[model samples]
Target chain A: MIETKNLRFSYNGMEVLKGVDFKGEKGEFIGILGPNGAGKTTFLRCLAGILDCRGVFVRGKPLNEYSPRDLARIVAYVPQRVEPSFLTVFDTVLLGRRPYMGLTPSDSDIKTVEEALKRLGIEHLSLKRTNEISGGELQKVSIARALAQEPQILLMDEPTNNLDLRSQLEVMRLARELANDGKTVVTVMHDVNLALRFAKRFLFMKDGKKMADGGLEVLNERLFEEVYGVKVEIGEIGGVLVVVPI
Target chain B: MPMDYEAYTRRKAFIGLILFLSLLVVSLFSLSSGPYHVPLREVLGILFGGGTKDDRLVVLSIRLPRIVAGILVGASMGIAGAVLQGYLRNPLATPFTMGVSNGSMFGASLAIILGAGYSLNSGQVFLNNPYAVVLFAFLGAISATLVILALARLRGLSPEAIVLAGVAMSSLYVALTTLVQYFANEVQLSAMIYWSFGNLARATWRENAIMGVSFILVFFYFILKRWDLNASTLGDDIAKSVGVNIERERLVGTLLSAFITSVTVAFVGVIGFIGLIAPHSMRLIAGGDYRSLIPLSALAGALLLVSADTMARLIVSPMNLPVGVITSFLGAPTFIYLLVKMEGRR
Candidate 1:
């Protein structure tokens, strides 16, 4: 569904993504794991085409060729944190359909937003202002908004960051279900255990390079130490893979 | 949850419709209640070319121009304020905040101190000629806008950067205006003082025509871009994520807003608080949606200014108090009430 070949990005004369190569397919939940400054977020942003970079493609078309409106229909990106706004949840989610909407939202757009809210179990919070909601509910609202875009690929930057335990699990479960429903879901995560439990594929990045890329087999003590400079033990809990630092 | 977004939209439309009707009634009332005391029947007749010569002179030749000019100025200032506030995502953002008013004030002061030949014998100074104060004020306002845009471009067009640059420019212009005030003689001083206070009495049929045309052109531009303004309130990157061409929209929106403000200020002097107060008031009455907010703010602004001008005309009978003075008195209390209401909500 998405591909990048030798993608390079720099900021202030410093190369943050040094010729990185990555690829993804439909119905895949990929977790990007690395330590601080490992270029995970930058790589995600490049894939989302927010940064001007060459060699990034979506469905075999070059990223640069797509207008912002067309590109929004193909990929939805959720930042690490969104500032609370005065708009209600429904209104904020409806903003996701901006690319498809006219001056006012069409019936289809409104229906899509409603479905997204219900999917996230946030239908009750639709009328409340976004600022009046909890951080966890806000995360769900952000996800609901992204879903409202109906994009083929979803990119999230540390969506579970600052979320409570239940909210974190719920979001991961939703991502897993989205992948099951044949959408490409890529997320940058710090919680390796959560990533291991939910994600079907993993990419470990270190110092602006991909250190490992595979299934559960790539997740080992050596890979953890190489990417994060830490030792970890891997086990199975309730038939799900779990990673814990020892 | 099958929420009724349509119902909310309908409610907003109803509120907007009511406000428009109120503005219509207020405008007719203002047209009828001048010193000449043209009756409502005669006012309607004059509008349709059926009234006596005396009633026609009062309604069509004199009162109609001022009323139309007041509406144009109010609507333009209100829309400009709403656009700037939404674009910059700051409640305090207005045309005046961009230093355009101060820049125009400085230019008017310069013309007052230097061009003394245009003063009337009745102790009132008017920028009646296009070659004198009006021309200088236009140049000053346009130049200020261009300079602010250039500085904002240098800093990645951050809202804070633009606002801070505007504040600096505003202070410098104020200091310059004060310096001009210090050097003025009695006639020039009164001219400068009255220009700063903002009077709607100087508007004639010609000026009203120009203002009306400008208001229509710019008002439609804002209406077309209202959705973009809503997207912008979500922050720069997020707005971009939603397919909004942030840089292009910001540039065009700010330039248009500044242009509207320059035209109004060039004609009517620095009418403070209308731009600052009208949009905020509209936001409170309506929701944050820009589609409804823009038109509603325009009507509410016309209503506020027309009502205030009518009151100014009534409080002292024949001698017209500057409409700016009335707006300040009315706007400050409403502004304080809004601030308190906002605090209570939070």
Candidate 2:
């Protein structure tokens, strides 16, 4: 399990994650919904052990106590943007096996990378350079690289940004399946409809603070106005709650 | 359509083998094609100890030491450039472009003006206190690394920022070298200017041994960090998530690269463009997978330098145009061709 207690992060004096508190249980799927500059990414980074902020604890220990490799074995982070380079997709995904292998990748490492590419449906692009792939394929490649790590907890920041609609649905489904398979999955998302449809729990953040946290009970007309600063109509569409801006 | 990955890796391995074989051929050709020319078969005979005394003297005493120097300097700069490009993720990043050479120039210049009492008479440069110049040049190169490392650690500068810092540092070192040259008399100034024109003949067996050791150690270190280097090319966030201590690797990588380059430059003076050209050419041919790029770039560097130094010795026949001038002359056009090819592909 991962949790943060009153986490606050300042970027050269201006606070981004101001006293944000959160926790995730095993097998929980959490969709962190927020507007721009709402500290969602910063809070996710803290959980991934990339940020050296106080109050982030994993598995009953403080974040700093674990070695980098140990933390990596437990948590994987997919950033908002994955830079394209000269590496082939297979080689890029093979980088995830780094913490476990020594000198050169072993057979198991190769198998794991192949499995990851297969799972992400990028096996066809294995030998192609990342720079040559389309944006949506690149997003899948990034997720496949993260998945190659086989982390128990996955943290994604806007993983579906460059993805098309079908790819976005596939990613959400994968996240949902990972949570169902007893891995903790947390994603910071801007699309509320997709989040509401696939993720069971939601945490709405605004101005570097958590404004709401719960299941469907947190949804209401006033909540959208408060969180996104826009009026919206909330209704049930085929048993899933839908929010339409009015 | 799916590409065959196993075949792709096999192709890269084949390319690497070809590069290694070519390096061998270049080395032998270098051994035979000097002013006191020995035939290739005779060169092989000399290698097996059956050549005439005069042939042995020319091959063993006059040519072998400088040829060995070329191999060491070229391979050193090549590996340095490859790893620096990997770490900084900047296409233009190399030990030369990162201000190490400029810093060495400043240090050599300072050593000259501050009483090394070097003299250049009728275009033949001589340094009385060569060791002092070497020491100061090494110190100057390391100082540039220290400043950049400090900024990266303290200020958390991005790769782009670090490259820009190198540019800024290079300009500063160039200006400082010019100022120091301004204070020197005719002999000292000319000595410094000639020193900056990389001469392979300056290295003897002792310098070659030192350079050989540094190159071996650094090459193994980078080989060990191949996976980390691969991770780094994807950017820092992904690298850290994949359990690489990116900052530590960056520091060690930059320091070791600078150390080897400083040793080479201090011994042989500044050999430009080998670092930039060798790695990029390999990347274009074999991709940026450090596993192959590391050793391949080193071999390519050696082959390139051996070829260039041979041409330098033979171009004017007994008047060796500085190998640095040859590298720039040849490197500029090849680099432009690569650039245009890359753009055309894009």
Candidate 2 chain B has its poorest 10 consecutive residues by lDDT at B337-346
User: DockQ of each candidate's interface versus the true one?
Assistant: 0.53, 0.73
DockQ of model 1, rounded to 2 decimals:
0.53
Candidate with maximal DockQ: 2
For every model in order, the fraction of real contacts preserved is: 0.37, 0.73
Instruction: After the best TM-score superposition of candidate 1, give how far the Cα of residue B132 lies from its true spot, in angstroms.
Output: 3.2
Q: After superposition, how far is residue B16 of candidate 2 from its true place, in Å?
A: 1.4
lDDT by residue for model 2 over B1-346, one digit each (tens)? 2247678888988987898788778878878986778999999999889899999988887788988999899999999999998899887888777788999999999998988856544666688889999999888877787798899999887888888998999999999998998889998988888888999999999999999999999999999999989889888899999999998898789888888999999999898889888988988888878998899889889889988998998889878899999999999899788767655433
Clashing pairs in 1: none
Instruction: Give per-residue lDDT, candidate 2, residue B86.
Output: 89
Q: Residue B173 deviation, candidate 2, in Å?
A: 1.4
Q: Write the per-residue lDDT of candidate 1 for residues A135-214, one digit (tens) a residue.
A: 88888888898899998999999989878898889899999999998999999999888888889999888778889988
